[model samples]
Target: MKATLIQQIEDICNTRGVRLTPQRKRVYELICNSPKASSAYELLDSLRETEPSAKPPTIYRALDFLMEQGFIHRVESTNSYVSCNSCHDKKHFSHLLICDQCGSVIELQDSDLIALLAEHAKQHNFAIHNHVIESHGTCPSCKK
Candidate 1:
């Protein structure tokens, strides 16, 4: 699954005529392999295992590149990153359902919700380049 997703991302980057540098790919792999959202420092630390000179800026730059390409999602409330399941194209919309107890994240795509938000934005004369809705609640396993 991880390999497949990475290949898909590589293809997307190629289609966009952007270079997914080795460091960026590593950072992306870290985030993709993680079960939960990962903070910048955590990613840096992990990256340091292989790249002893890896710095915070290194992770940030890689993350910035990935985010710009819309291959990853940033959890706003917690300030972490996650690559949710299903990666066929550059993710344009992110509606996340977060588990407050287990720290799990589920990314959802709802066209109706997107339209709703767009309508609200239009009413207020707001031009949204991109948006994410982070809704926190307990998961079924956590509820148990």
Candidate 2:
């Protein structure tokens, strides 16, 4: 939980005129602090440890807001979510490297690749919305 990131997200919310409610804040904090991507049920269970009244809708709403704000990315393959540290910087397409053994995620951005893909999509008449490239392998620690 870096104070800078929290401040940046707070600033983004303030600038966007969106309220970062306590529930949303807590859920995101959990996601950001996690060593690996987490499932919604895991988040809900962890959140419930403190907020006994927390429910599925609460987690869903937080996830929605987080995604909309681009502060987090959903790992499509494993049905999990990871915090995007650079998302507060800008909006761009990125590929993810997932550690199959540890479930840790690393995000990689390639503007040239994104441009090429966009061009290819245009050629194929495919309108891209959400894009996530998940490549799974062992991470450095897991390679041991």
Candidate 3:
């Protein structure tokens, strides 16, 4: 699983023509391994264990690159980031399933749902440059 995620990250960087530096690769690994949304601070803390030399700006720059490449999504409500499961297309954004209790986040890829939301916006004469659906509730584990 880790290998696949790393490959995906490399593929993304290659497809987008972005250079994947070592630091970027490390940050990518951290995001890919996490099951929930993570903040830069959290990632930095974790990276410190394995890479004590990694600095805050290094993680931040790597995160910026990932986000720009559509490899990750930032959850505004919780101020965290999660790898996007949506196909890495510039036109797609993953709908976020957020667990309020534990701050867990799940990425849902629903093309039909996205179309419906777009149609709804058209009905209201609103032009959506970009948008993400976020639903907050307790996840199964949190409920238990």
Candidate 4:
């Protein structure tokens, strides 16, 4: 999974004319290998193992680039980041379902839900640009 994700990131960067610097690639790899969303500080600490000089700014810069290139997603509620599963696909809005027990996140793209939200916004004369919905609950694994 990590290898495939890295290859996809490389392909997407090449297609989008985005530069995947060594630091950015490493940061992305760290996120991909993570079992759940990771905080910037967590990334910095891990990076420092190999890159002793790595600082918060270094990690943040790489994260900014990765987010801009659609290689990752930020969970606003948790203030952490996750590797985007839809990086190689067309841009679309997605909500996150977080497992409170395990901190796992499932990205969901529901057309009906999106459309309903859009319609609701339109009723109030608001133009929808982007949105992030986060719902927390126990996952199936944790429920068992």
Q: How close is candidate 4 to the true structure, as a TM-score?
A: 0.94
lDDT of 2 by residue, 51-121 (tens): 99988998999999998888999999999999896766646678999999999999998888899999999
What tens digits encode model 1's per-residue C-alpha lDDT throughout 5-31?
A: 889889988888999999999999999
Candidate 2: regions farther than 4 A off: none
Model 1 score (lDDT): 0.88
Model 2 global lDDT (CA atoms, 0 to 1): 0.90
The positional error of residue 123 in candidate 4, measured at the CA in angstroms, is 1.4
Q: What C-alpha lDDT values do all the predictions have?
A: 0.88, 0.90, 0.83, 0.89
lDDT of 3 at 91: 53
Sort the candidates on lDDT, descending order. Answer: 2, 4, 1, 3
* Best model per lDDT: 2
Worst 10 residues of 2 by lDDT: 85-94
- Score every model by TM-score: 0.91, 0.93, 0.88, 0.94
Q: Write the per-residue lDDT of candidate 4 for residues 1-144, one digit (tens) a residue.
A: 788888888888898887899899999999988888899999999999999999899999999998888778899989999988788764668889998888889998788999999999999999987788999999999999
Query: Candidate 1, residue 54: CA error in Å?
Result: 0.4
Model 4 clash pairs are: none
